[model samples]
Target: MFEVLPHLAPDPILGLSAAYREDTNPNKIDLGVGVYKDEQGNTPILSSVAKAQKMLLETETSKTYITPQGNQGFIDGMLSLLLGKSSPVLLSDRVAAVQAPGGCGALRILSELLVRCNDNAKVWVSDPTWANHIPLIGSAGLKIEKYPYFDKATASIRFDAMMETLRQVEKGDVVLLHGCCHNPTGADLTNAQWDEVLEVAKEREFLPFIDVAYLGFGEGLDEDAYGLRLLIENLPEVIVAASCSKNFGLYRERVGLAAIITEDSKTRNIAQAQIQSIARGIYSMPPSYGGALVDIILADEALNNEWVSEVNDMRERMKTLRAMLVKNLHENGSPKDFSFVNDQKGMFSFLCITPEQVREVREKHSVYFVDSSRVNIAGINQQNVETLAKALVSVL
Candidate 1:
């Protein structure tokens, strides 16, 4: 059986990281991994998180397993964060949430629940969604389909094409949407476009499964959640998988929440039990550290404010980096119009360069990123932006 197993290729993103680490070039720039990096090229822990960890260390009394739902404070805090405190869904008692290992874990658990609920349901994903989405959702015995999403040539969302395909979706199918900060492509739907998609969902009766990974990375917290909140308020049933990795800077802690909103309290209770059952069969229990950290930050008014401020700083830095990259590109004599990068929100954006160009830059200039040319904007800084621009220009 061991001999019969086939060798597998490493993940593209992780492979890129390995190659980057091995490169002897001192000026080599890494725009491959999705992790947030500060000006000093570090994924620093937020100060609020540090404070929370200190508090937890001093106060935590036991090492026993938490409930299947993980931390109740985390669940309540995250639900309130995702949906407004006064959201109708909350007021009506129609949402069920459970903790998961990470965003990946949340996605898998939610996908499993979808299969358990309706095995035949097809899940429609964006054409250029996060690479992990395919295996995470498809492995749960659901057929995966693609709808038009990003247009690499234009470096923008293919809204009309996306709407056209979604309109054809059958009733009871699941449509996976990036809540904000779309992965790989970085392009996202406008509010008007979201409304259009909502109308289509209403007409077709398809279930909406939202992936909220970069909650505060794109825009303000509430602003980033606009489309997701709209669906929850309007639709009778919705699914959400949220992460604390980006927002709380707890990547290794693997904190995430999988939530489902039903029509009423009765259905919500039933769905909650089903989700907990699915979690028990998969991971048995979720980790407590990350969730506890998030709970601490959100529960304390002073710490919550501090966390929000830190998130705002990160967001502004990325925005500044995007602008600087475009400026440097222009200065480097590349005739390409990369102005779209400034308009796109989040840490990622496709450079819209060909695969050959991507390879040439990597080989000749030691500028590392995935073959798709999706770069982590946070990787750009005052020090290496010019080098990156020069590399890109040389390839072009």
Candidate 2:
């Protein structure tokens, strides 16, 4: 059995990270991982989280397992955070939510739910979605299909083509959508475009399974959730996978939520039971520390406001970095136009460079980004923007 096991290639992103760490170059840059860093190249813990942790330490009593659905405060807070307080869907008695280990866990649990609902369940994903989505959902024995999303020529969303393809989805099929700050490409749908997609989902009679890992990264919290809320308002059913890793800076804590909306209260209760049962079969129970921290933060008005402020600051920093990179590229006289970089939201943007160029930049210029030319915008700063721009110009 041991001899029959085959060797596997290292993950591309992790492989690049290892290579970057081994290189002794003084000026080496790393933009391969999809993590948010500050100007000092640190993933700082939010002040809100710190305060909440202190509070939990002082008052918390039990270390035993919470419910299979996890903390009620956390689940309620997440629903309000994602769908807003006044959302009509909340009052309709059609929604249910449960905590997962993280966004990936949420997605996997939802995939199991889909299979339980229909044996031949299929989910449509974007062409250039997060790399892990394929494995996380597919490994659970769900059929996967791709719809045209990113247009490489312009490095933007291929909205028309995407809509046309989605139109072909059969009734009751599941469609996976990025709620905000689309990963890998960072190109998000406008409100108008979201309206179009909503229309298509309605007409096609398919359910929307939204992945919202970077909710507050695109814009404000409310602004980023506009499309998702719009869908919840109009449609009778939808699925949401939300993560606290990026926004709350709780990456290591593995905090996430899986929310589902159904046609009526009975269905909602049944769905909740199934989700809790599925989670029990997987991780048994989500870690209590992260959920407790999140619950405390959301329950306290002052801490919640501070968290919002911190999220806003991070969003603004990314925007500024985008502008700095674009300005540096233009001033450096690069042949390629990178103004689109500023338009893209979130922490990532694909450089649209050849694989050869990417390798050349990494090996020759001490610049490290993914082989696909995707860079983390947060990895750039005032000190290194010029150097990165020059390195990119050399490759071009």
Candidate 3:
């Protein structure tokens, strides 16, 4: 059996990360991974998380397994964070939430839940969605399809095409949407565009499955959640997968939430039972540390304020970095205009360069980017922005 197994290629992003680590170039820049990095080229833990950990360390007493749904405080806090504190859904007690290992786990668990709901459940994702989505959802035995999303030519959302494709989605099918800070292409839908998508979703009668991994990275918390809230408000049913990896700097801790909004309280309770049963079959229970930390931070007044401030700082830094890169590219006399980078939100954007050009930049300039030319805006710093700009210009 072992001898019959075939070799597999490494994941593209991880492969790029390994290559970057091994490169001897002193000025090498890594823009491959999706994690947030500060000006010092480090993924710093938020001060609020540090404080929360200290508090937990000092006062916490138990190491036993948590409930199948994990910490209730964490579930409530995440619900408030995703929806508003006074959201009608929460007040009506129509939402069911469960903690998962991380965003990916939340997605997979939710996908499995969909399978339980409908044997032939099909999930439609963006054409250029995060690569892991394919395996994470598909491995659970759900059929996957793609709809047009980002257009490289204009460096913007292909809204019309996306809407047209989604129009064909049949009832009971699930559509996976990035809640905010769209991965890979950072281009987000405007409020008007979101309204259009909502109209289509309503007409199609398909369930909306939203993945919200980078909530605070796009804009303010509420601003970033606008589209998600819109769908939840209008639709009788919605599914949300949220992560604390980016906002809480809990990457290693692997904290995430899977929420289901149902048509009524009875349905919500049933969904909760089903989701808890699914969690029991998957990881048994989510790790307690990360969820506990998030609960502590959200429950405390000062720490909550501090965490929001820290998230704002990170968002502003990414915005500044986007502007800085575009400025550098213009000053370097690049034949192309990167002004669209400034208009986009969050940690990533496409350079819109070819795969060959991507390889050339990596081989010749020691600047690493994924094949699609998506770069993490957080990877650029004041020290290396000019160098990166020059390298990009040379490749062009």
Q: What is the lDDT, from 0 to 100, of the residue 380 in candidate 1?
A: 94
**Which of 1 and 2 is the better model by lDDT?**
1
- As for model 3, its CA RMSD to the true structure in angstroms is 0.9
Q: Model 2 compared with the native: what TM-score?
A: 0.98
Model 2 Cα RMSD, 1 decimal: 1.0
List where candidate 2 sits over 4 angstroms from the true fold: none
lDDT of each: 0.93, 0.91, 0.93
- In model 2, residue pairs whose N, Cα or C atoms come closer than 3 Å (at least 3 residues apart or on different chains), thus clashing, are none
With candidate 2 superimposed using the best TM-score fit, by how many Å does residue 129's alpha carbon deviate from the native?
0.8
- Model 1 TM-score? 0.99
Weakest 10 consecutive residues of candidate 1 by summed lDDT: 84-93
lDDT of candidate model 3 versus the reference:
0.93
Scanning candidate 2 in windows of ten residues, the lowest lDDT window is 9-18
Local error of candidate 3 at residue 89 (angstroms): 0.5
TM-score of each: 0.99, 0.98, 0.99
